[model samples]
Target: MLTCAFLLIVQQAGNASANTRNGRFIVTITNNDQPAHASLPGPDTLAPPREATFAEGRLAAAQTGAHSYVSPADSAVRQQIEELGSANTRKRVAEQDPPQSIVDTCRNDPRADGGKGHVFHRLWWCQEHGFTARATDTNGNLLGEASVNYVAIAWGSYTSRDILVELQKTTLGKPTGVFSDPDAVRFIIGANCADTGTGNGCAVHYPTVNKTLTEWGNDQEWHNWLITSDESKSTSPDLVLRHRWNLSASVEVPGGTGGPFPSPTPYHLIRCDSATYFAGRPKACINDEVLPYITYEINSAPAISVHDVAVHIREAQDTPDLTFPPSPTPKRIPGKYIYENPKDNGLRRIPEADEGPNRAVVRQACDQLRPIPSDEQCDEYPFASTMEGAASPDWDFSAKAVNGRENTRAGGYLRWYVFWDRMLYRDMDSYYVNIID
Candidate 1:
């Protein structure tokens, strides 16, 4: 039974290699809401735009005479408003308009909404997350309000390891609440890197010129903000937003250092906060709202290799359990095989036959299922080319007996994969393997 299974497994493995579609990557977006509305004042404030009640409140407030006011001729606008109750003159305060929508549909592709365009469908890999603050008086009447939408957009290049990134902020529209001075309420945006290896760095490059919220909001251009990474050291570039939200009106970068490990790929974690205050009374500001964590990989590498390469181990044909000892462990779970070299300072190069620590483990596992026929080889689930191979300290793996010729062909396919997909060194890259029929 075992000999017949090995023959079938090797033949199917060969067929799989011939029709392989190697390099494909999937991105995941997570909404972090741990830091939102921590400091905003009042109980009857407008909900954040990302919430359902926010739109309802906007329509309700608009009907309640929450109209935009123009600064009157008098310099003491506050005093004039105080003298003429809010119901009378309608306090004159300046609120900024929402950031203009991007013109480049190529970058900011319109997502198909319930068959209609929705506000949340602006960025391809980004979800709008931010703060909504409303300043109210002792009587709880709405004074001033502002909504800040922080969007971190990143796209990895298919040809290189570099990533293209930009920061997007929008009020969504004019504020329903009014404020005193236009500049009294301020917001600054910035970024910081986290978990990058020592000596490795990530930085955001953009113009130094200061612009008003209107100017910043109106400029929806691409490649305007660039995020560059240092290749000297390898790490999983994570972005963490600290409490100091006093950055300039432009979007920003993040950094801390560490060795590389298993992760999706290069990505950004965007967050927003408005705990800042200007010289104003009846003030309110949101503490923070960590936006969606955007992660993606450019799997395509041109003629040298197939893009987004993934390994597929067919269960019925691969016969994972048909070893000499007849073990029943399932070994082809998708994405379990991570190509890495943790024993070698986080490098990603596959180790040679005698170089890796896994050789001992592979020998031991194969020895346990000994008395093998000369025509078959000890086949491992992670292929001895990944971090979780037979020699892994975790000892969380399986090995099977497969035909020598078929296993050799599969090895050839993996060798070609490394060249075709431009698999980078370190956990900076990753690929998934699926167990199919």
Candidate 2:
């Protein structure tokens, strides 16, 4: 049985439109709330899209009636009528009937509770980009109204679906094949790392390079295989990774007497750090190493090329407040050889020597190094480890060393520290072989 759930009456702001010339009224009836005169069967026994009726009256009369029910005050009734004027004179009208589609979609066809007296009656009016629904009482009194815009809903759904699909693919362990093509790697890095005036916001990055990097890095299947042989590590750790590796593969080696570019094809590195764990196990240890290969041509002087590598070692420090020694180091790793300029804080320093293979060229370059004036705070570049908490501290480094050089030239020396984490083995080999060949 079609039941009235609610009733709604809307006042037309202007003359009624042609379609609503008879005036518009919305009345909701449910089998559970059947009026005394209603002879409809229970919701479960009646098929839906059935028509139902409701009793409606002037707003003032309804109010007066409700008050009279509470208290039979003759004087109060007269005062209300005098203030509200003649109820019969009010031009109360019903909303046009709801379209058949709304009736079919929202009407309770059969009692969801199997005739337990609970049934829903909903009426909707389709609009341009969306639709609106209203619930009304038996008297055609407005109960509530809800409006939904389909365009916004669809957009939200598409965005959510895209993210979910990408996330699933990432979790499934897809191969990036970045190592196979140096040019492709370079292009990706350039596209992502270029200064596009967007201030390196994550939202801006999500649709471009960051999305790809995240998908590639989150390949759980690939990580599982990458760490399968390690007895201590059962799965790839959840790394705080980013794309900050820079290479000199595109530029002429500073020294080397013009032999060849150190790297053959231009490629970038994916920098990552141990910051989180899974199943109560530490994901990755902070034992990775960074190396910088620099070539300098001083005033037409013979070009000098130097390669240096460094590993971060946690040192124990004594403190007065703690029973055990506290590591004096702040949660954020500081640049190793690099120091924030106390003066302008605009400049940085790199070693001038050209001979050592494991020399200190830039200190803690991949650490949480910030730009000068401190207020301009170093662009954490892509992600900020502090936001995730000290317990999960990590930084992913990319192999775009040329970007580091560019950063240095731009006076973002602290930001340039990411170059320290370059993947010398894989990327450097490509750097040398591609150029030499």
Candidate 3:
């Protein structure tokens, strides 16, 4: 029975690999809101001109018992009123006119009632930075909303160079082979925030949006991870890293503010590393150790009212049970696998001395099987060894006020680290790391 089951698993794995043509996959992220469909205004849709007779009739009603009803000055005032009303009508129509499109398909999406409503725009072939979008109402009010959907297609046999080129073209907008259908390629949604909210699900402040992306690209730790070809090479066989942004204006708080707050520009980056693997085995050997690291900078001090700022590393808690051991079990093999490294094992922390202005640089390496010590000290190292069985150790990072303050209101840079071991063959196919506040 065991042999039969193993063969079935191998067959399924082969089928999955055959389905992948060139090893290319598409990734899409959206705001979870539906795309805004509104109508464009044209020259013929202006409000009709108001009649002079109707205006004069209303004025006569107000002067029925007044003594100045038939004065010469009243006739002159009526004439001026009619002229001003006509001019005002024309001015409003002019203000409502739509701007010329920079590209052929870039135009306002017409509304159902044949009135100006919303704008639906597309951004393809980005020059620098990733694809982004923004929308506004007829009055030029930012909707602070976005939704995206996209898929990946394989054009040829998968190669690291080819995969990287496509990723840069789709994300940072590097020019590549001309795509026939720009509209079908990709989309972006961007908007400005008018104010901050005290509740969850509010608009994301504009400053936070700029700060997060800027720091992500500038931080040295992030740069090393992104540029280091060998570190993540096993997990990213095609050398393609997938990222999706979930831009939100909401946050969790005590007592639940009726709505979302815009202050923290809450966002998440979903990263996926794609490396090919066979049924229950990796195509090539990899280092048994996995190291995921994050680096951040506090650009300025927190508000005076703020008390303590902290960084937290959380890992999944589960016991490891072995069903099938290695081909040949060791004579002294233990009953169960040790899921976590010792508290003092392979831990490193380097925190810069505090300056008078509340600025410091701190780095911590926390693995899935181990937690940062209660006193937050890293002073030990242990011999590294590969695990005897497959395990998944997922971890995340969050920086905020531990006490006195409710949430972080100030701006700072933060990144998270996640590591995987070679014993788990799946890491060669894909790996994930997350950042949060």
Candidate 4:
């Protein structure tokens, strides 16, 4: 899933039709509430594509007959409506649904540069409302009533450590009967990031304000909020741990009729450390990002051409027909290096004198070419630092007789590439070696 998601981002990064260089937040409100009456049309009456339904029997008691203004049945229904509304609001606020694809949301976002290589973030949340009101005639006669349901959603899009929050509402139902109260119901949607004792601090640029649900059948426009934090100053910040942070979005009804819904039960909407952000945007964190990789140019590092040649030949065409010199295989050589102590099995960082188990294998492959010069050494493909080294039992590797000094220089370059690329341990990460002439 992480690999596919990252690949999607890479693909989107190349699309030319993207309109904005900054991310955007889209919020929507949906109403599925309906009047409580057997004679009234049901959800099937709604236009095509809407699958929502009202709480069938939730307001049945009120529909039987209207009672005194302070009747127990009326009060119970109101309380039930409030409870359901709060619970639904909590569930929606805790959930997340990205408005668009990753790169489209990030690169096109206003916060991110209209170019590649910058980090962007996005989050989505929804809040539900179960509303009820007493139905009465102009002469104060009792009449059947219904409990109405509504949903509000908030989407937060950000880039380079800044958060942009936006809220929207959609009406799924139209209330027809006259209700006692006609005032608009207001809601508040916002976000927060708690300190985990880490020096990294977070702040909201402005306070989130309450927007009205506006009458019975009306729609709500998007509201906005912003949060900002420090970005790493390093040129290559993928491996640097500048600030560790987690952000949670929220939705609430001010008068306690709805909710103070926080993040989901155990998850934050989004969490990003500099490493995962710059390396590649993960679903939400470092653990979920695609594996790291390194690219080596054979032309630039000519001293290691022998090592490249070995790999090229190893992955070369198995049989040659009309071709004079067989062409190297088009497929890339994929392998991973291991540096962890226990997992290396004495193969990593093989010594110059003994060559360890790696030397024994390489000697068997290159013994025929030896005795040429003392300055030369037997070189092996998939270096001793890799799990697919000459000593590895699971994989077949190649060995070639090459200049010893040049081989040593190649080894130094490999070390620098590993450190600079932040390659992780075997299994945790895998990389492809793209041999470019």
Q: What is the per-residue lDDT of model 2 for residues 182-299, given as tens digits with 9 covering 90 to 100?
A: 2221111111221112222111112222123233344332000010011122122232222211111111111112111111111111222232212222221110111121111112
Error of 3 at 1 (Å): 40
Worst 10 residues of 3 by lDDT: 1-10
lDDT of each: 0.31, 0.20, 0.20, 0.33
Report the poorest 10 consecutive residues by lDDT, candidate 1: 1-10
The residue-by-residue lDDT of candidate 3 on 17-63, one tens digit each, is 22223221111122212222122111122111221121222222222
Give candidate 3 regions above 4 Å deviation: 1-132, 137-149, 153-437
- Superior by lDDT: candidate 1 or candidate 2: 1
Comparison by TM-score, 3 against 4, better one: 4
Q: How close is candidate 3 to the true structure, as a TM-score?
A: 0.16
Q: How big is the positional error of residue 76 in model 4, measured in Å on the Cα after superposition?
A: 67
lDDT measured at residue 349 in model 3 versus the true structure, 0 to 100: 18
| Minimal lDDT window, size 10, model 2 | 152-161
On the 0 to 100 scale, the lDDT of residue 142 in model 2 is: 46
Q: Residue-pair clashes per candidate, as listed?
A: 19, 54, 22, 14
